[model samples]
Target: MPAATSTAEAAGPTAERAPHTGPIRWIVVGSLLTGLLLAAVLSLVVFAGAPEHVITGSALLGFAAGWALLAVLSAWMTSQPQRWAWVPTAGLAATGLGLLVVAPGDGGLTAAGWVWPPALLTMAVWIGVRIRRALAAGSGRWLLYPVVVVIAASAVGGAVETVGLASDDPGRAMPGEVYDVGSYRLHLNCTGSGGPTVVLFNGLGLTSANWARVVPGVARSARVCAYDRAGQGWSEDAPQPRDGNQAAADLHALLQRAGEEGPYVLVGHSIGGDHAMIYAARYPEQVAGMVLLDATDPYRVGGGPPSAMAVLPSLARLGVGRLPPTSYWSTLPEPAAGQVRMFNANPRGWRNVRDEIATLPALLTQARDLTTLGDMPLVVLTAAGAEDDPARLAGQERMAALSTNSSHRPADAGHGALLDEERGAASSVQAVQDVVQAVRAGTPLL
Candidate 1:
């Protein structure tokens, strides 16, 4: 009976040991794998062309903290990995919801920006499930370690790159006179000297710097003025719901405050053409003539305005529109190209541009109701390609009819002809010069 009792006690200890040993083995294996994977990732990040600025002690500390936290979480995941399988999935879902609530400036996630978060979460959940199953099965466990290494490497690379990107600054210089137009400051650039000031208004998202192609030639002929619209270019942000009416009123006030007398020759391009028409109609006495360059039609604004359904409030809440400076400067001259890049990088520029696109339909409707230009000298310059589209040509012809003295000038140029080219000069600049000459001489527009 004593011998039987001794055998039973030994069997009881053996039975309890297997279950206890299994969990400890899993925890030890998971921790070791996690440590090796983290070490490999850290080595990759340190040697993988990390920027000099992000190599500081603080950055290293941050990376260490992040890695430790991730390792702990991953270790926990290996224990009952299937039980918390839904956690990462829930996090991914929450991120998507957050993005929707904080609508970004480009309206949604850009192609480059959308792939990382959800993909990482999916990989993590997959790794967790694989580890749990492998531990339970006690076979094929080593195979899953490679996945951990790969995920860790990728995650580390992305984090490092993100840190580098945030640390770099794209420096931009402001080179125009700033006018406090009540709520915000607008940047204005004016030169030359004479009456009937040539007031240049650019298309959507364009700044005073866009006049680089045309300003030099036009300034040689008359006192010309170009400006950045409110919350655009180097201008300050204003209140919400920015439309053409508010823009026009602001310009009027700007000119007054600047002591620039009118009887002005309003030169407008694209959407600016619509604003010019509105300005002329509203303040006819101040406007001496008008020039519309590849102008949008007031009757039917070619492409309908973008839908206003973009949750604008989310822009402020989410801090969404900050993008890397674009490289569109290749099409423009040196300084102008650089200026364009800087303006594109500005978050406020995107906000204002989106607002303009949203309000364009309403602005077009308002423009259609504007009174005729009467005998005001008007020059409607159509892009050479306009002849290919019968509807567009007809629209151009209708624009010329707004004034009895208006002339329809078809340029052998495409859109954006106003920008000064290094070779042959710009036909758009010449057209504006001709109009200024005609207006100054009090000659017939034809």
Candidate 2:
């Protein structure tokens, strides 16, 4: 009895410390979760109401389900905030699947045009509740005022950015014809009487149709043209592998079929930028100058769906690649309905991402074997991205390095600056004008 009593006395403090530790643990977990949830909610505010084509009832339903799941997860856990954070993120994934499977480009909500206000409001509400509980705990008491300011500022900034994304003017694509290049075809839209043709190569998941937002400015003086690359939009797919050389060869055939003149000004975005570099190197006489818009160097990075497909191998095997997209109101099944929502939510944008994914293998090779434009005048537009995103930030950095190495403009703009809401397209217009002036004057556009 004496020995037992002694042991009990020794264990008493440790046992007492354990229960007191509970609130501390909960506070730490809750704090981390609060920050993460706030970030996600902010991102969603910018993402949910984008200028997307898909706006289906099913997609909305899926988003609601995801939101509900996330909220439940948040409320269910009595202590750990991490549980709540994962709820929306996971649900968003499921909803994205549903969006990917839907057809008719039905994907995300575009009823309004900005990402911050509603997001800030939601975050503020969540934070207010969390803060109340957190303040009672001594650890986060000092952070109360700063947190309030952040919530209010986020709402204001988001509203401003949304206003910036929308425009009173409705842009339109110029008229043109289809140019058949051996195995595939390209839809060409050109303007101007006769000058060095400014060729626009659409990026992955893009087509000639997207240029309507920016083509008008350059059309006055230069023979500017925008075309849907083979296997995209109205263009047909090629049996030949998509490589730099093959792309150049196909382009030669396209030019011949379309009766387009030589010494064209080539402007490309993302993967198309790789193709432009190749085309200029392979056929210098046919090319005059080049413009790269937040271009992706396939040599440095992987092609197609870097996420879901190339990055996540386990999910890739499960056929995220094969899954039909979930756009707005899509007619998709179980898992697939969840994918399209995400694909549609992207800001750089994609109208037909799934079809583009199918051709990624060929473009992978095309992305390679592209370098050394030599004397070709090149202007590169670098994209500004968040610091947290290494992939995006690194890709833009590399593109800037390439442009600098090639003796071109390596300035930063929004990722989709060419289709930018305000001053975004201005950079492109200036680049084109410089190229046109150089070409017309018979001077080096380096």
Candidate 3:
């Protein structure tokens, strides 16, 4: 009887402890889930309303809050406390605080890239080791494992992107001359040698590298120059409010500084067409001819909400943009294709996209200033199926009507394909050549 009693007493403590441990494990799981939800909500709420400079930091702080929650809850409820959670909590809090206090802008965020990735990786590794030792075989470690893995993945991705940024040198990859266009520099790669130089203007988010296929075809007959506008490709960034007028002014300064004489044939694709029109309007005597390749109508309206501008840059800085494959630029030939891929992956480039989109409404409004092109030799090449949209077709016709010597031609290709695909690019090449020929002959287009 005494032996049985002794055994019962020995089992009593473990039996009582089992209930507490089981509930605590479940509570830890619940805490993790709740923390994740809180993190998401806080990030969204902060990003929606916070100032542009503080949005990234606020988002990071939200994540830190989640980790802090885990630390507090585990220590308060569980017998085997996850005190190690404080490490990540403290690290994230410090980083977020630094970003907020410094207000470092894009340059600061870029420099921070070199610091955070390895730091995060080390923190994650330490957390994993602590987790293995602190948590028993089946006590809520599974819940925390996924979070650790995600952190590690993010760290690795950031490292890869940092390395890519370090290696990508625009001067070495692109054959161009960088000229000081006022305060900032612009990259211009001009090829061939002839009268009436064809200055190529890229579409939204495009650079000189995108003109690889079109430039070669046009350079066969006339001098073709393609340039990266401020904050794109190899060019240095300029101030904000980068509207059409600003872009035109920059182009004017760039050409004059580079000694690329005027009375030039302007070849603009997509939004570049709108920029060309603005340029022609601003400097009537300098523009000899124009070729619009699936150009965006200056009158067109609609863009993403303004808040997206704040979120996009932050996401890009975190290496979210590089998660996708570089296959999008595969249609472009080697070297150029590689160059495009590298630039697109850059966080600064994404910020440029944000700034451009933010001012698009103003840009479109400014484009309305161009009322006519008079007798300028102009070709408006519309992509296939563009005519399906009545409004779009009308806009194209209107642009064509601006010039007395203009012709509206339909290319059998998609808008982007007009420059990306060989067949479509050939059609674009022909349009530029036709305008060039007309300009030289001083006659109407055929």
Candidate 4:
């Protein structure tokens, strides 16, 4: 009878040890979700102002922490342990530490791209297979599927972006000459032939290709030059903290080296207007006339949230930016359109955007130093909705007041459409033509 009782006790223990079927499964799931939530909160609150690499590394570490939680909690509390979670935990932790220690810049990140994508894909596949084998068929298994999907998708996107980056050869594809502007090279595409050369300055985060619609029209009447700023399009990356002063200095060097002489008719759109104003302020003698197309107000303050800016480069590196369709660039013509899409997808360009935006407050402040353009022919083209915003209209009026010979014309298009759309480009082209004619005739805009 005692031996029978002992056998029954041993069988009871085995029965209790069956796969977790109750509240503990949900607790295990909650652990991973909580880890992810904590990571997100920390990223936005604690690391938002940190450098790009640090922010990226911290995010990886956050993900690793989530996996670590899954490994520990599932093993400790549940009958069906997710021992495979340790694989991702270890991999992510090691990668995060490496990023923190190496602090690799853009080039290093690009090089690492060739390795990490395949490794990530293999790891994700292994994890998925392990989960399928270990987890029972139910809600718990289904709950984990989203995590696997996200990791696998990230791997695929990274692979696609890596291949795209590898194939893009800006030097070979450039339509114009690349001139060494002191520290870095700038791409300058010039067409047509006439004096008081028209130099098109791109808006914030834009490449010369954005001028596809307006350039052809302006080039017909006078020589028009469109060039990429440092760290944009075909231009090589420059040192960071690229303010308006640095931009103006780079342009000056580019023109001097390329022998594209300019008492330039500066055609600037959006933030490009701020850049043009800075250049005119610095070297008033070199500017013959000006056209401000829905230009950004230099006195305006604030921009994108610092937290969003911090994570942008890392997200871009993972190819999140390319998930959106190519339709955004559809308004641009071929070759130019393709070029814009390619460069826009590149992580380097996104980093440049972040850097430029970081210093935009200072750049705008610097532009305010330009109090007057004397009698220079200036045409300020305000976007359609300016009248709806009192402050914006006031800013436009102030810019027009900079030159005694200036004319402020309200356009029928939106801010970007002023140069991107046909009707708006026509308006921009006419403004440029009017300014050119005035410069040549030595008369005011009629």
Best by TM-score: 4
lDDT measured at residue 240 in model 1 versus the true structure, 0 to 100? 64
Candidate 1's C-alpha lDDT? 0.63
Off by over 4 Å in 3: 1-45, 48-53, 77-80, 105-107, 136-139, 304-313, 316-326
What's the true lDDT of residue 161 in model 4? 83
The best-first sequence of candidates by lDDT reads: 4, 3, 1, 2
- Model 1: per-residue Cα lDDT over 78-157, one tens digit each: 34333332343354344444543553332233322345534664666676665666354443355445656655555444
How do the predictions measure up, each by TM-score?
0.65, 0.48, 0.89, 0.93
Model 2: CA > 4 A from native: 1-174, 239-244, 304-352, 358-365, 386-412, 444-446
- Residues 300-382 of candidate 2 have per-residue lDDT tens digits of 53544332222122112112333344434123332323322322333322423543554555665565555555555667776
The regions of model 1 sitting more than 4 angstroms off are 1-172, 301-330, 345-347, 420-425
Q: What local lDDT score does residue 286 receive in model 3, on the 0 to 100 scale?
A: 94
Report every candidate's CA lDDT.
0.63, 0.54, 0.81, 0.84
In candidate 3, how many Å is residue 372 off?
A: 1.5
Which residue pairs clash within candidate 3?
A: none
> How many pairs of residues collide in each model?
2, 36, 0, 0
How well does candidate 3 score on lDDT at residue 124? Answer: 88
Among the numbered candidates, top lDDT falls to: 4
**Deviation from native of the Cα of residue 428 in model 2, angstroms:** 0.7
Give the alpha carbon lDDT tens digit for every residue of 1-446 in model 4: 99999999989866765546655468657867776876676667777746667877887888888888887877787777788888898998899889889998888888888999889989888988998898766637777777788888888888888887888887777888999877778899999998879999998778998899998898898999999888888888887657899899999999998899979999899989999999999988899999999889987785544676667777777787677766675477677777787877767767777777777888789889999999899999999999999999999999999999999999999888887788988999999999999999999888
Worst 10 residues of 2 by lDDT: 309-318
